[model samples]
Target chain A: MSPADPIQVHLVRECAQRTKYVIDLPEPLSLQAYQELADNLPGILSSVFLPSGDVLLQIKLLEKEGSITGSTNSATLHVLLTKEGHGRLLEHILQELRNQ
Target chain B: MIDIREKVQFVPHLDCGSLILGGEPHVIHCHYYNHFLQTSIEDADGIYPAEQVLVGTAQEIGHSQFRKLFQEKGIQDERERKSFVEVVYSLLGMGKVSLENVSAEGGEISTPYEHYAYTYAATFPPRPKGKRGVAYFSQGYLAGAIEAICDLPLGSMGSRQTACLTQGDPAVSWEFFRLREPLPLQPSVGEGRYQTASLPQPPHTRVPFQAIRDAVLGLPLGPDPETGLIEAFDVVLTRLPGNYYALISERHFQHMLSAIGPDVIPLVLDMLVESGHVCAFNTLGGIMCSAEWDAVVRPYLDNPADWLYGIVALMPALGWGIVEPLTYPSSHSWTVSLHNWYETTAIAALPNGHTLTYSPFAEGIMNGILALVYQAGIAEKRLTFDGELYGSLFRTGRTYQSTFHQSRLQGAPTDVVEGHVAR
Candidate 1:
């Protein structure tokens, strides 16, 4: 959690089923950590950096639905956030984005 | 504020599974059923003078309901009557309205939040031109309320949805005027034919049906004070009169069969069933994914297939009637029987309903439960509810299918639907 990294979480919507977080990456991922991130706390609904550099990394957390999620790419890694504890982190991230 | 949610008490006939609201037989239904049934009704627009049946049916029911409420509650003042109608409209999750400008002479009112206009708009892509809009339910209800308030007869007032949110309009607006000639209409067949039996307790499942049912019943799914829309389960919802859905659906199906000929039958039936599919994905999926489900029902889940049992066990609370699981051989397959089901029971009671081979709506619901629960692994948090995911699960190769072994609407003892992965 370095201030130098400055990850941007654009939008955060809490819906009936899941929490949707839209973020813009300041820098691309290593592509090596795809499997590791896919195996954790929040499910990656759609994490695409695309052949073009456009990014849409929507991460969702459904409690008790278990922790395995996300899709991999030969291209640059799409998202690099492990937002396990959904409540305050989401609110804090949104507040940070607002402050920015 | 009228606060009709407080004024109109819901007396639940727990035995028969009937919910009586404002002296009308009301049942809680999600947007999926509402939009689909409306599509089926509006499908017969060309040949049948469908407006009479579509809007008129709502008018008849609204007229009856408002009249009863007026007499029972002794609602005499015109201003109060107007407030009561608008409040009840929002209370049912149909969205808000402004009745200040409406009167016996022609007048117009508008809303940015009519449920039919908003949800129905989302169901389809915005047209480049000519969106007739989908707020007829609210349209006719308001029209009928106007009639009752003005002390006019049932068919004395006429209304039109001049512009709606579905049409890409900023607000949904309707114009009401005294009809030059009152349309011929019939009063609603109140609380149509109902039969009941004690719910079955199969020895195989551990999900507590009663507690979940009670929990759902207790949720105060009322409208927001500002917006006046019931937003829950990730979708706009309504506690509608079930008979209105039944009559409109049956009339459309019968008319399509007779006037349009046998060629349209398959398409019509498919659309009817697809409505149920929509319900399962949105309504049922929303329920399964919600925090309330986590607190109330999710802990009871042992096997993935138990999700199916947990869902059906409490559907009677929605007043759709009792659902009993006959067997759950595997996650890929199962069989469940519906007894005294709402759609079938209503159709069996209505005169024109004899022609339906199966309950199109219910069968679609069966298909969705399998497509979602077992195939899509909804319980495992894999469900994303996007178009691509929906296609892969419901339309692509090796999709789940449902077969009706018995149909109670056709006089069988009980309606049985068996689901499994397609061969």
Candidate 2:
């Protein structure tokens, strides 16, 4: 996938009343792969926020036969915060992903 | 095959909240620890003098983690942000725990096995979404779950000298109220009767006294002081079962009075004996007026304005019962009745003063009493002077029986003293 291309990503709330942030991957992603990435997402994202503002991002990965693979990965970014004070939280995620 | 791995349901109600520690999401289980945290942390500093240090430490840690998580996650997206925060809020529903300053770091901290413990049985808020749903979690949720569980830290140390070590933060209020000291002895007078030293009357104080007096006149006085006498107000503050702190009104004193019958008196006692405070007072006898002591303790005990827990054992009788598996249960050592009985009974008049009697119903009351007292002295290895005196006085044959009593066996009495008649 080219970085310039518009990656298809949807920011959806599974429950109207709940505040959980869910990003649907176009292809299947295995439970373990999703969890491993999700577990580190907070810390990685916390470390990557830019001085300018909040980080906006998401990743798409393949889930084949209910198993996750890095090659199947895709990405999206969201400006979750306006001020850099807390905005880097999202940036940290992108930075960690880039580092990986 | 029943696939347990499938995405079942995420019940928002089941979520207690989450604690973000080190950027890790720690999910709080509502059923497990929500109410516990609410009571622990609602306070500004999470300070409490409970025998449980874990609870205090957990509260402080949880609070800090919570504040940080929110500060870091300034969720701007309306939909996604709500979901994230709802999870956080549910986790906060878990109880709080904190600790006193490290008491000699690196040393082993005490646990429940070695100290007094307390817990609030609370009711929780229902699921925010529709009622029907189960909570599902992936391994990613474990870190948060563990963080939440870590909130209630258990400590075994109790500050009392007889206790091994103080376990909990001593600042938190407890359901049990103690008097400052033991009842001061009224000066002894001629004859067996107590001189009943006159107490200083309530001064012609202004304001509050007038308010109380006016309130009293509005109500009908009962037959006797014991019945109608509104001695003093006992204020009880307790964290209720429904995740709230309830302040019992003054009217609730009637319920307390009924629970711990009128026989219990508020005598002038030492602060340690009275133990009205949550912490243990030093055991020392200090001269103070009895009425003054009673007045000091009356407000906390008598006023219903005090906070009371829904599950608190207010009455001594309600406190009695062998909690199952008696060994590890918290109620095992609950001596409410025994303590109350000891307080009401005069130790000096008993066959063995100071030495507590374990058995009450013996066939030969006197013989059993003497034998038990005698045995106690020998067991303590104090059979020299006072011990010897007790042994001799309580021996089977040496005890004096009143003439014309049931079996006043006299003359060449082969055996059978009053204490050993049935034994």
Candidate 3:
């Protein structure tokens, strides 16, 4: 809930090994946090730094909607686009934010 | 403690080639189609009264449907009726809701599983305002169900989604209350005027319509016992009311034509039709490449072009209508006719039958069927579907197109959709 608290991630829809997920940031992701996620993304995921200061992700990771909640109203970044892996990519997103 | 799922039945009107549930036709469509069509209507928010059109259509259909269901079952108890509404809502894979304290006067109800909100949030990634309470369909649907349960006159009740789980809330919630002034609603034409003739059986086609239809219907297309969501054919499925789709699309077309003028015709028509393309590309393509297709319908695909026959045969089972191929197997340069197709039927049922031309949904499907059967490489199971795939296949490259020779709503013998070769 705090600005420095770790983000919450939830799975949305997964089909044909492709997925969609949300990583709730109570506060908007700092540029550094976005950068850290991009840098730390699994090799399967190729990240493109968007001009709008958001990251657009393509599922190089090949993978997965569930009841999604806990995203804040600040802004929805193309942040940590997790759609191709199991829950690990989402866990990676949350853990990396915690490390940050 | 009756088993709820077992209670719901999709009776086959094989002669008409339709599935009737709770006295209304139902069709199986995926999230892509639902999301696309819903957003298309939502996109015209300011241009027209989009919310009114969307919510009102749902409320109207839901009211008509529940009223019949309650009578058929003789469900007299208020609590039993409420429980019945919730069960059917989930049974159809719309999403599960807690109608725990919901009633006719007004009430607040929430669920993590409402279809529209959850799917919308999943489809579009995080946005600044956070998309909340997008369950407009549920808003109107539950409202109508309550009114029927209470035996209230149509439009006596109204509902609004207050919070959406997709919006970061723990659940999607709605506030239902008596409308200060009841809406003058159009009674839902439960089943439209459909021409009944023997289904077209082209002599050369190897796939027999009756055989495939019976097999496809036998497949378990029901919702998960727990989540009440159907994840089949590689897409989340919903047994959506046939009238809900008919009312929204036809109403939107009418609104655009009247308010925006004829100059907007080409643009609006193209956009509306694209939802069908999205359905065929994703839903149809997904089915062709699915294991279920291999098990049930695949054996009938005796020839390369028979894929078209095999797929169309399953249309009725999905409650779309009786799809008869006027032209034989080859994908391109063929014509398909629809009898009692939900879109046209729903529209004709409208008082003073509206003139919306050929159904955009059918046109898109006609074009998409060809593309999926031939272009997407589904025969080889080499489909690589994504957001980009639609563009590459439909918007660009050598793309297919459909020309509507006749429209059922326009007093044609039947709805005819002809597919032309790629441009």
Candidate 4:
């Protein structure tokens, strides 16, 4: 869960099963970053998610303000890890972000 | 002056609209008799009476006496002044000057020959490096030409027509159409036929010139975030004399697509298209379809995971080509036979192993599988694309089946005897 490899392949798969959105992170994300991503929800008009630890996650919006309004037509989310989810294995990271 | 006896008296009536001005030896009594006559009507609404409106009797009976008395008391109290300037020619002496015909109408004058020269000159193409014909002429030259014509002492307002012919037919005017890029010629082969409706011919009306000009003068203009747009262009529409109008603001144009919505947007798009105002449709990104597209596909388009699914459903609705016979070529790639040209949309996979698509019509099969893989990866707590197979493409959409089958026939070479190249 470093910035260099923020999004792991496992997270994308997990996101697809639990929710309609499948977001992959390329780098470790921060809580503040996740909030900022959520704020852009109106423009993206699509569902977005950020895995925070194993049980908590953040959401963002997609498909918002159109071309005329200068919106980029995208929604980006960042997920961060909590102390409990730290592990050499990605399973620990998944456990931290998942609600269960 | 005549004096009245103290014993003389007058009767007072409250309902009567009359006023007594004085109580001296001579009493001046004013009566609004017409007002009383009109007041009796049920629907008079407290307006002046009809009798009072007539000039002969009610006027004489109510206020004529006062006029006569005033005239008797005034004599020779005003004087007139001579204010006319006289002009004399050398040949004429002792000629009386009179105010013959004083008119209030103003006029305009023009120089047509000069305009004609400029226009005629413009008929010839410009030199390779210099500005166009009219533009090549210095501002001062144009100004001098204008001053010379308007300076004509004997010219009539129609002289302006002469100036127009002389200077040039206005090749460019405030009313010229403004567009950053040219429009598409015809709907792309599979693109839906945008319905067109006749808009009110742009009103041949003009706003007050000064008011419109003043609206932008010294005003603080800037991008407003609340409107979610940027300033882009401005124009003035002039269809009447002595009237100028601001037809547009660049800032407003920025958000026009979303603001106008589907119903009225097509009218403008039609105009732009017909006029060659938008040059190209370069990218498949952005929300190009009208709100109708959103309304019809809202349930599916909103989820990133269903991006491909949603797009497949909308293809037929959009009248764009459909994706059919989606065959997975490999674990990470899929092949789709499109009913129409596929340049309008495409999809790609992100470095994070999640699939991202930019198809305005439908998310391809490959992107859907990528979505599944990404979801599985998240659940497994590993950012991996290991199980993602591109070749196992799933076919969707009833429209795709027909389109796919049709494409097979249409794309086949006539001379092909078997499943080999025609050659």
Candidate 5:
């Protein structure tokens, strides 16, 4: 894919009870790229990769009861990504985005 | 009189608690008689008996060693012998010693001892604080060394540490007096034998003040492994009084934190945060604050972003290990993880075992700095620990999370704060 081309990975909820998210990739990733992405992701967000080769991105999102109520609370985003999905994310950030 | 500038060679080796110096191995250790007496001695009356026995025994041992070393050198001249004794004292890391007046006939010497080791060691205990010139082991060592060199009879001399650094004196001064009668011994308790306990050792490596200062000064001002901004903080911390940076040994730092206790940690944090505010205002003032935010901290000011990068860059200056950032399921709030934190490590190093204590002072300091830089009030702060790494976060604030939370509530406002925008 080109640097300007958008590579969007779909976020799939892993479990209904938890805030876990998993991103499935269209292609399998090389071991080298997966490792590189794993090493570098800490610079962006606090995350860990599961033994199943899925990356978990943890984020805190602000949640409000309703649009009209306006009272807000905090929530965590447990995002998981497949090896290929992580590789694409890293490529888009480190390579393509930097070129722009 | 021997010249004061003569250099002496010393070989040192650490053997258990003692720091043995010189070729023949003259052993010297910073003994904690006070700690032993306080913890082990049962009755108030038993204290003096225990102290006398312990000090006398140590003195006798020191005297024999000094006699052996002196005789081996075969220095007949009195002044030369005294000078040699001074060198030995200095070589043992016992601080500098200079004799002022020596009276051979009177059997006394007036000397000034600067940076005596015992005085430095005494400052660690939070209670039963030290009095001026109460370094028993040091006083005993000095007397023994003098008596050995002078060839005086055993127990013929008594020395008093007149001035002490613990009492804010620049140096400890000693006045040695000739004793007409033999030393008096008090009755001993528990089968006429005294038991001594050792002081707790520091967990982290103790770097000399000069070494730390030099290392900090030698750091490159340009972008290096860590950011120069953090290096600047290192310089400031090193320059604080009483070797504040080096004095903060891992064990001692932990002791101080545990002493504060968990219930008091939040209050201490709040106080530190307030202090940070006052300090920030005094140093940077209100005007230059915006210009001082580094690249790492600038971007996070507007959006709800992870602050791990900034914390990681700043950890070394704070004397911490690599921090792992952790996130909770509820609230997009993130907390920095403290791995092998000074307190945690120190508590683990305790010999008698220790109860778990948590202090959010580190988190408070970070939050305070962030609040000051972003020019925002802290809204919600929470601290948690999971056996290891202590995790903490500020959920609501105008700076990182607060600004992001506010924007999210107001339909994702595009405009950033004026301070962050200026950057």
Candidate 6:
């Protein structure tokens, strides 16, 4: 979470027909941080709020690339985010990084 | 929704009749149709057969337009198609149309009443008071468009304006329902005649103002100025050309007044009042002296109802409003309301959308006509504004109200006739 130990983010091509970006997180953050990310992701991705208080992410096709990689002491996992999903994930990461 | 800016270009179509500015040919001119068609429908008493024909024609036209737009645009995608329809509706001033649960079968479409052409048309002359949904043309247009867009069999698709502006609804809602059987074909009554034809032709031959002035001066005074005035007007009405009404359109008349400026309007109106009195007295006197006076006119004078219809029929040909009987709330008076007035229509058509100054010419004529028809003395004749659009003509024995709403679209310096008739 320090300035020197920044989260790694890179653009990558999934195939000849498609391209995406990958984000490698420094650590599996606290549950509270994850919760905050989930809450703010919708507003970051789509400005409109649904009746159920959920936001539908509207991302352009070009922004749909990449996956979010989270690692712990024992294991690593990757979650694919659409363009809008990528936006929400990045916003959450920036917020957590700023807090640290 | 596909951005229209990316998908289409709007160049003005060469043909004036085509409502579609650009895109492939699918001409639909709802505005023109709304103005003229509604005028006809109003004239025809808003008959069901006329309504049915309008609906049928609209649907046919909708089918052709939709077919062309869909085909030329290659709009097979559902979202794009919906967007296309909405854009088309918005462009045509049908309001921003939205479809829900739309499929090959049918859907619910909704639009704000503000965009409906009928919302504006309903306000036109002979404005409907407390009437049900009068957006007959819009209803048909939607139905026809949907049937074509969905490729529904003719008459299988039915659309109704569930909510209408005329009914005080904020938005017009239409439910598209499938009919078990095709709609029964009704004999087509040709499009009703447009009121544009009824517009007064400009007076090519002018009547010299001096001649009228001299005629007024030379009118022989009888027992009193009132009696002599009536005799003079009767002579003018009888000997004047059939197109004497055309003189009201004389530019020289208006130009002369304009040259005199607004100061002369009152003086001119005072002259009109005297002329009105003269015309009324003449009419009554002529009827009294007629060969059939004892048999026909006398009975009507004795019983107001007997002669009312004859007077009503004669008034419109003389460029007046339709007269309907109104029950007199008081025992002492008889009352009738004039509907679909020609004067307000003419005035409303002037100066484009703005109002014109009030002219006492029509009012005076109405007063004169009412006084004679009711067999009331000049002193007993009275005219009063009911609302900006309506006026009531009252005589001592009977009352007549004009249903025509005065043209609010025109500008006037001051009201020519105000307050109750001066005692």
Output the number of the TM-score-best candidate: 3
Per-residue lDDT tens digits for candidate 4, residues A1-100, read 4556544332221111111112244333444443444453222222222111121222322332111110122122222221222233234323333321
Question: Tens digit of lDDT per residue, candidate 6, span B1-423?
Answer: 557634543332221111122222221112222333243333333323444544554554455555656777788766666667655555443455665455556667655532333335333333354554555545665665666567665566776656765555666666777778877532111111102222121122222222222222222212111111111111212111111121222222343355657675555454434343433333433333221222222223333433333333333332233333344212233344333233333344333231234434345444544544443432232211112112223334324222213322233211222212233
Please tell me which predicted candidate would have the highest DockQ against the true structure: 1
lDDT tens digits, residue span B1-423, model 1: 555456776666665566766556677777766776786677668778676677887898888888888888888998988888887888778888878998877589898988777776655666445646688888888888888887889998888888876667899999999989998876766666666766655566677877767666766577867768776555668887776776777777777788979998888888877787878887887677654454456667887777887788668777777787888637667888887677677667664345776787787888888888777887765355566666776666437667889987667877898877776
Give the C-alpha lDDT of model 3.
0.72
lDDT tens digits, residue span A1-100, model 5 = 4544343322221111111122223333333444344344422223333222333232222121000000001111113232333444434433522332
For residues B1-423, write the lDDT of model 2, one tens digit per residue.
322112112221111111113232222112212222222222212223221222322322333333334455442333333234333322222112112221211111112211012122111233233221111110112112222223212122112211111223222221111124422112111011101111111222111322222222222111111111111111001111110111011111123234445442121111111121111000000000011111121233322211111001111111111001101111111111111111112222222222212212111222222232333322222122222443354333443211111211121111111222211
lDDT of 5: 0.33
TM-score against truth, every candidate: 0.78, 0.17, 0.80, 0.18, 0.32, 0.33
- lDDT of predicted model 4: 0.21
Model 1, position B324: C-alpha lDDT score: 77
| Tens digits of lDDT, candidate 3, B347-385 | 887887674777988888988888877777656544556
All predictions: root-mean-square deviation over Cα?
Answer: 10.4, 31.6, 12.6, 33.5, 23.0, 30.6
User: Lowest summed-lDDT stretch of 10 residues in model 4 chain B?
Assistant: B237-246
lDDT at residue B185 of model 5 (Cα atoms): 25
Share of reference contacts kept by candidate 1: 0.02
**Which residues of candidate 3, in runs, are more than 4 Å off?**
A1-84, A87-100, B1-4, B127-132
- Alpha-carbon lDDT, every model: 0.68, 0.21, 0.72, 0.21, 0.33, 0.37
Spell out the clash pairs found in candidate 5: A21-A80, A60-B332, A61-B332, A74-B331, A75-B331, A75-B332
Query: Residues B249-338, candidate 5, lDDT per residue (tens digit)?
Result: 222323435555566444433443333233332222211121112211322333223222332333332233223333321122334434
Query: After aligning candidate 6 to the native by TM-score, how far in Å is the CA of B195 from where it should be?
Result: 26
Residue A64, candidate 6: alpha-carbon lDDT = 36
Off by over 4 Å in 5: A1-100, B1-46, B105-132, B168-170, B184-423
Candidate 6 lDDT tens digits, A18-97: 22333345554443444454354322222222222322222221233432322122111223343433456655645654
lDDT of 5 at B217: 22
